[model samples]
Target: MAADHVDHHEHHPHGLAHQFEDMAQQKESVLLGMWSFLITEVLFFSGYFLTYLVYRTQYPVAFAEGSHELDITMGAFNTVVLILSSLTMAMAVHKSHEGSKNGTLGYLIATFILGGVFLCVKYVEYSAKFEHGLVPGLAWHPHGEHSPQLALFFSLYFGMTGMHALHMIIGAGLLIWLLVKTAKGTYTAEYNAPIEVFGLYWHFVDIVWIFLFPLLYLLGRH
Candidate 1:
């Protein structure tokens, strides 16, 4: 009986490590780590954006023409969807902080569904592009005004959106794991660092799309 009690106490201690003096310190540590990682990610995406600016400047007409080929309606719709997902994700974190397990799970499911929807829309766009032979290096044959630079434009388009989509897939996977843990009550009002960290990541992904939508879809809309 003493051994079982000792194990229970060990498993259900306060939400701070021995090295950390309090919950605040532990939470601060987690937040700092996440922010630092996000900063690096920002720099990485900035490199891509810098490359985009240089190329767009080089092929202004071609880039403008290529941007018009993208489905503005679909891109706009995706922006709305991602914004909603970010809201649900924030709600998930808040609910976890409030000790509402069911609320957290529900919000997380909503976020996961929205993420999947974004990927599906991206698939539709990509499939149409592929059917039209717009993808570069794979039987690409442009028959439009931007024929010469269309390949370069498409290359960048694929590179940027593909990287973003990969992040969404990973985020969805993380939500699945969070869902399981929430179902099992691994996180509560006292300890919701995992979901909070994931929220940071999700918000980062959404912010990236916010930039992508305007640059890729709205360049020639006006």
Candidate 2:
């Protein structure tokens, strides 16, 4: 009787939720939910991307001039940093599958740090734009021949990159929560769905930046 009771509590506490019949069912439900949320995010970003395409096509010269103002070196560095963070995030998921608490903590820490670094670099870039009076509305100063179109390029720049940065900030917050739970041994080989699901989110953020880098920074460098 004691053995049966212990098994019941064990599986209920960590392995399965009340709505789920078993561990696999719980994981599948959670993953499906995460994917559903991500699909909406894709739709959200797609609108911005489509708008950018339309405007860039209409104002090619102005957009190219705006792209020239961006620092490709810094943009490339952040791209590499996000790529490395994605690798670390994948490793963290792997460690969770192995039920290695310390391994998961270490990799999560690395990912958090990389995210911070990316945000810091973006801040520097934003500050430079502000100093140069490139920001739209507040202080409009355009060095390009097409002032109106040049402002449009910067408007799109901040709108897209700012949203991406906000996502990174939110991801960083999630990582901190994961780190705390991981340290407490909340996840194990049999029940690591949270970590795995978060991996999908982190990967999506990285992929968005991959697209942003080329579209905003390398659009007309050639």
Highest lDDT model number: 2
Find the number of clashing residue pairs for candidate 1. Answer: 0
lDDT of 1 by residue, 1-222 (tens): 455532223453446667665677789999999999999989988888998999899988888888988999999999999999999999999999999999999999999999999999999999999988889998598657768687888888999999999999999999999999999998979989989999999999999999999998888666
| Candidate 2 per-residue lDDT over residues 73-92, each given as its tens digit | 99999999999999999999
For every model shown, the clashing-pair count is 0, 0
Q: Give the TM-score of candidate 2.
A: 0.94
**Model 1: per-residue Cα lDDT at residue 138:** 80
| lDDT over C-alpha atoms for residue 182 of model 1 | 96
Candidate 2 deviant stretches above 4 angstroms: 1-15
